[model samples]
Target: MLLLELVETTQTVASTRSRLAKVDALAHLLRRLDPAEIPTAVGLLSAKPRQGRVGVGWSTVAAAKEEPAAKPSLTVADLDAGLDRLLATAGTGSGAERAATLRKLMAAATAPEQSFVTGVLLGELRTGALEGVLTDAVARASGRPAGAVRRAAMLSGDLGGTAMLALTGTEAELDAVGLVVGRPVLPMLAATAASPSAAVEATGEASVEHKLDGARIQVHRAGDDVSIFTRNLADVTHRLPEVVQVVRSLPVRDVILDGETLALDEEGVPRPFQETMSRFGADAVRETVLHPWFFDVLHIDGQDLLDEPLSVRIEVLERIAPAHRIPGEVTADPAVAERVSQDALAAGHEGVVVKAVESTYAAGRRGSNWVKVKPVHTYDLVVLACEWGSGRRTGMLSNLHLGALDPTGEFGEPGGYVMVGKTFKGLTDELLRWQTERFQELEVRRTAGTVWTEPVTVVEIAIDGVQQSPRYPGGIALRFARVKRYREDKAPADADTIQTLRALLRP
Candidate 1:
């Protein structure tokens, strides 16, 4: 099929929020797509070629500039080649060369195509149609079950390979058809339960472990070489040398262990979530102090345990993993699990993740098979300021200043209040307007476009615990701090006190 056809289908899919309609459109597009073109098309769809920082910056500005309309007859190959040329020439040439190249490419395409290509390069294609949606579409077009396609695709991490297998009868013909760590595997998406009793009822028999307030890390070790990847599958090996050292020290070779990476206090309690994140950045691997806690093993000694039950894999994990592989685990009783949960909270940990004894590791699946039960509710926070939001949210609120009540702070000197690390999540048009308006009215300090708001609003914040922080005005910082609600009815004075927050420090 022509690139324009696919682009048209994308437009149709993008316009509709109805998942079923989007799926149907995608399925139709997949049916018309030449299987051989799948890889190149996917690559082109995901490409953002840049030769160097200079070229990239220039091209970004050039692409942003408005240009005169030109005839539209560009093919996908032509566009791909142009992008490759732009990236290759980005830092190597003058500003004029970069601008001319961008203008030429822009002139060759229609407005819609330019928009689509731009979105793809920026990795912000928000059509709600991801790999899963595409898998379903392919299955619908070819009359195969979605599960079969998902399983094959997950094991290979190749949509084209999975598509060929689903369309043509070649899965049986292919060799090496199981999950491998270090390679991207679609994680099993999870479902939610309202309460602990509901979780118990869903699983029947379960093993619960302390749900830590840490970064989700996947460790893939092959012999002396070890690599650590974040939940997003970005290579985080450098930022976590301590974790790398621990994994390299393991007796077992050729293994993929899944777990969390935490920054612990002197007393061994997990530190603030931001501290854990701070260990990762451009120089993260070089300087950040991090610790790993292994929870599951997908592959060990050339064995793929993804199809095996959780009970069997845990046995393998416990055998090969290092000692002190996280704490507070192993129990079938719900009451015991509850005790574990309480102890986790009492000891300044997050909560517990209850896993079904017979549950298999379902890649990219988030089912009730493994349920996370936390003592506190966490909200998605939006960074209001670097403390600047984008566009209108700019200047005043860039770094999000997170606040939670100290139900227990009054007993302490200066009578307690604490600020958590700033986050930028859950911002909507309305919330941005309210915040922007409020900040303008209550600006205490202004730097560039940013304005620090008066500490007037008390947001109900949930967190794992409090830890020492050198950044915030308050000496302490929040761990995994997130908004639970806007405490419109409660005054800041009535918000949880510093003493209440200090009560959670169980080190």
Candidate 2:
């Protein structure tokens, strides 16, 4: 398959809001791919390369900008090989050497191909065909059940690998994919509810656990060795030695635990969300201590608990790590669930997550099986641009211009975004300095005081609610919006949509 074809399909997907159309076009393309091209093609389509890191920065891409080739020639293998070269050459030379390599690769592509490659490399692709759409497309192309494909990918913890199998392997092999001690399955996500009572009412006979404003962790233990992965499946065992020690101390061997970890103040209270997330970075200060609190057990003693009932998994979790478990109660009463939520708030936690007692873990999907209730309204929005800071924040990219996804093009181009609001609140000195340096690497355009970037960075914004506004394209603006934390785990496509925020206006 030609790289041009992939580029065209991406444009086609981005050009519309109809998910069915996107899946159909992608499926048509996938069916034509040679077996060897599936992984590379899947990676490009999803904007998450299998190589894990492309290492090409915005400046290198800018330096490589020139007249594109006249005709199409590069194959999928050719593009894959070029990306491999970029990955290989990273960290081995100066910026000029990397720039030269990127220039050579870009010189071989047409205009659209260059843009597509740059978008994928910089983690800024605007294609609306996220994993959900791509998974369906894969199933459509392979003539397999979407559930089977999703389950295989979740269990194997590798979408690219799953795509390859779905295309070339049998259904039996895909079904055989199961939980492995070292492999991290995607963590299950919760849908949002207006209140704890509402959530409990929705999921009857629930385990309502305190929703900690902490980082999600999936810890895999094999004997004494333990590995901790973030919600995005990035391994951070070395960065979180304290967490590793805690999981390693669990009595049972070969267990996979799903939980939350956060930095704690001397008062034994959880620190701010950013403080806990800062520890995940490579250059983070190591003084703060992090603590792990398990809430669910996925596997223990060679038995997989993913398909088991939540009640059964809770039994295993309580037996193995009761001391480390998050505080909550198992109750069917909405009033009891409401009390748990209030207690969680009084104890300085986010809220409560009500989980159906009989529901099995559904990895990588957000459904009503588990519903979270937080008092404050928070939405994950993308950083569309950053304005130069004034006052004490001068010379820093302090004020952020935020946007929400307009997925169906009701307010804008299909799959494009609509600017909703801007806020400079909740930024610390360290965060301002970090943004000043980091946003430059993602820069795409700029004005005298603002630097526009690829809509890749997702930030969680706490808002009072939305108010009617004509200043923004979406016709609604964030009320009392402030940054809570930068969501490095989420993709731009995963950010909350404009429609969702506007729906908040409903009485």
Candidate 3:
């Protein structure tokens, strides 16, 4: 298929907010793809090419400029072949070879196709069709059951591969895809709730477990070989020998465990989230060691418990790895749930996750069956600037640049604001339009992407917490920061001080 066809469909998907419209556009495009091109096309549209990241960064894409072709000629196969060339040169640091290939590819693509390819390469595509939506479209186009396609994708951790099979292979072959002991599966996700009691109310008779402020890991073991994967399904087995050792110590010959791992202090309290992430990004073991805490078991002794109830999985997990289990209690009482929440906070944990005991393991889905409740720290921060949005959010003022008042001038002048972080989340279309119009009126200067505004707009920002980072002048950054609301009632002088945010960096 022509690359322009896919680009047009992406535009269609982004132009509309309706799920049905997006699915219809995607399914229509999928039905037109040849068997050989289905996987590449799906991967490109999903912004998760089979070749993964081909070592291309924003600077390379921006620097290797090329005028768009006047007419469509590049095929999906042509694009995939170019990426294959890129993958071969990955980590070779041959910028000339990679840039030549990328510029040539861009020169062949039309304007729309060029933009789509750039977005895919940069991992910034905003087609509005998430994996679930695309899976539904794949099923719709192929006449396969949605559940079968979803399960295959969730288990295999490859939506592109699953789409190829669902479209071309028989229903028997697609359905036959099962939990493989050595392969990484998509970890189950959770929805957010206001409080533990609210979460328990959402998922009755729940397992209220302490929510560790750490990294999510999925461990798969067969015989003596064990592998650990991050939440994104990236293999980190070599970097996490401690996790592999703990999983290998289990009695079961074949098992799959899902849990969190973090470096703990001598007091056994969990370390900061960034400290654990630093180890995850390491090439090899470091002085900082991460310990595993298993909360749920997916497979045990060749038995696939993915379809089993949470209660059953917890029982099996407790039997197999009781010493490594996360602390929690199974209770229906709101008071008991509140106690668990308090206990988690007192233990230096994040919060509590209340999960329904009867809910089956719904991998890759953030259903209401499991709800996470964490306390949020809110502060009124001044909006220093706003960057231009992308794809569907284009032509809007999004991604607010936040700053905190540095009243004592410890990091800057007295009564000045120090840069903290930026966030584009928790925005509605109404808010987007409001900011686009309002911020431009308050603009003091402009750049290619951002409009610097007068430091008079005070916005209420909610953050999970603050972490130590040298990127900001304050020596800290906001973690999981999102807009609670625009603080129209508050002034820039009333914004929280940099000292207040710095205090969060303390234990």
Candidate 4:
């Protein structure tokens, strides 16, 4: 398949707002892909390369300038070669040298091709379609059921590999082949129920676990050797030496456990999420304050418990896992679960996760087997303006200026609005680009390079709570306010009233 073919599909998908249509279009393209072309195709579709905040920018015009002596341009083979060279030079060169090499390779391609390469580098290809959509596409192309394709990919964490296997044989045959190969497959992470009623509806009986505020970790131990990794699969074995020591002491050998790593206070209460993140940088490994709490075991002693039900896995986890676990879990009663939720909040924890007893580990699927119940508070808000971002967010209006929604539905008048804060969180890069373009189209004022947008995106803000503010019209401010999602389904006229804000004011 030509790179242009994939690029056209991406452009079409990026322009479309209807997700179902996007999925259908992607599925059609996948069906037409040659089996041998799947790996390069997937690689092209998923590359997300990002430059740092500093350095020269590359626009179409910029790329056209200072053209090199039309040397033989990059091909698929060149991409592979470039990646090999990058890996070879990875830890040996200065950051600038690596960045320059990556930039040169990226510039050698056309715009769409550059987009593809960038996506691969950033580890996320936000073409508006997720794994399920891609799975459907693969199954349609390979003449297999979507469920089988999804399961195989879940087991392998490599969609291209799964697609290859599915095209050639049955899932059972693939599983047997996988066992023989003995390569580490994907770990099955816990899923969540979409709603409280969904949690009850899924399992006939529901159990609740305190949803501690921490980072998700997967620990793999073989004899005395232990490795700890974050949810994104980046190895952090050296960063948390204390946690590694704890895992090494567990009696079991050859086990994989899933849990949270937190920073705890003197009273054993968990520290803030930022504190845990602080222990992740280049110098973090030497810090000793990080603590871990093991919650589930997906594999132990060569027995893969992923196929087993949650209750069964919990039994195995309790038996072979470490004695120290996240404290205070209540089961089978919503009333008691509510009390536990209250206790968790009082103790400075996040909230509770109510899970179904019989739910199996659904790798990469947000299935309705677990439900997170966080305390929701509402804030009246106004849209100020959006800001441009760097790196993966280049040329995009990636951050928002948020203000309390004036009860009077007025701006610039007395007590009309308050500029509380700004946030770039909760937005995927694709969303950033879309918002940037939209903001430009809706620009009401312009200053320097910044454009003030029409206050059209009305949204309700949720946070842990509010804090006193020197800024903001309501004399209080939102804590950790982020775009939960665009309120496109909602009109500004329907925004939460100031009375709601008054009710939530801290005494």
Give the candidate number with the greatest TM-score.
Answer: 2
C-alpha-based local distance difference test score of model 1:
0.61
Best by lDDT: 2
For model 2, residues 1-507, the per-residue Cα lDDT tens digits are 888998899889887778899999999999999999998888777767778557666776887886898998878998788778777774545566767767877888899988887887777766667778899999999999999999999888788889899889999988888889989998888878888888887888999999998888899999998998888888888888888888878788799999998888888888887778777664444988888998899989889888899999998888999999999899999999989999999888999999999999999888899988889998899999999988888899989999998867778766567999999999988889888988987888799999998788999999999999999999998999998889876767678889889888857
- lDDT tens digits by residue: candidate 3, 173-278: 9999989988888777776677888888778899999999777888999999998888777888999988888888898999999999888999998886557877
Model 4 lDDT on a 0 to 1 scale: 0.61
TM-score pick, better of 1 and 4: 1
Q: Per-residue lDDT tens digits of candidate 4, residues 280-391?
A: 5445454438777766677787778777887887787777653756554536655566677788788887676676778777766544576666676534365668887778
Q: Return the TM-score for candidate 2, rounded to 2 decimals.
A: 0.94
lDDT tens readout by residue for model 1, 67-185: 53454576666655666666666344556686676667666667766666555443323343445566787778767777777787766666666666666555453333667656766
Better of 2 and 3 by lDDT: 2
- C-alpha lDDT of residue 248 in model 4: 75
TM-score of each: 0.70, 0.94, 0.77, 0.66
The alpha-carbon deviation from the true structure for residue 8 of candidate 1, after best TM-score superposition, in angstroms, is: 1.0
TM-score of 4: 0.66
Q: After superposition, how far is residue 18 of candidate 1 from its true place, in Å?
A: 5.6
**lDDT comparison, 1 vs 3, better candidate:** 3
Q: C-alpha displacement of 75 in model 3, angstroms?
A: 0.5
Q: Sorted on TM-score, highest at the top, how do the candidates line up? A: 2, 3, 1, 4
Regions of model 1 farther than 4 Å from truth: 16-21, 43-72, 89-96, 141-145, 164-169, 173-176, 189-197, 282-288, 330-332, 381-395, 398-507
So what's the TM-score on candidate 1? Answer: 0.70
Candidate 4 residue 45 C-alpha distance from true site, Å: 2.0
Off by over 4 Å in 4: 15-37, 47-75, 79-126, 168-173, 177-204, 282-284, 328-330, 377-507
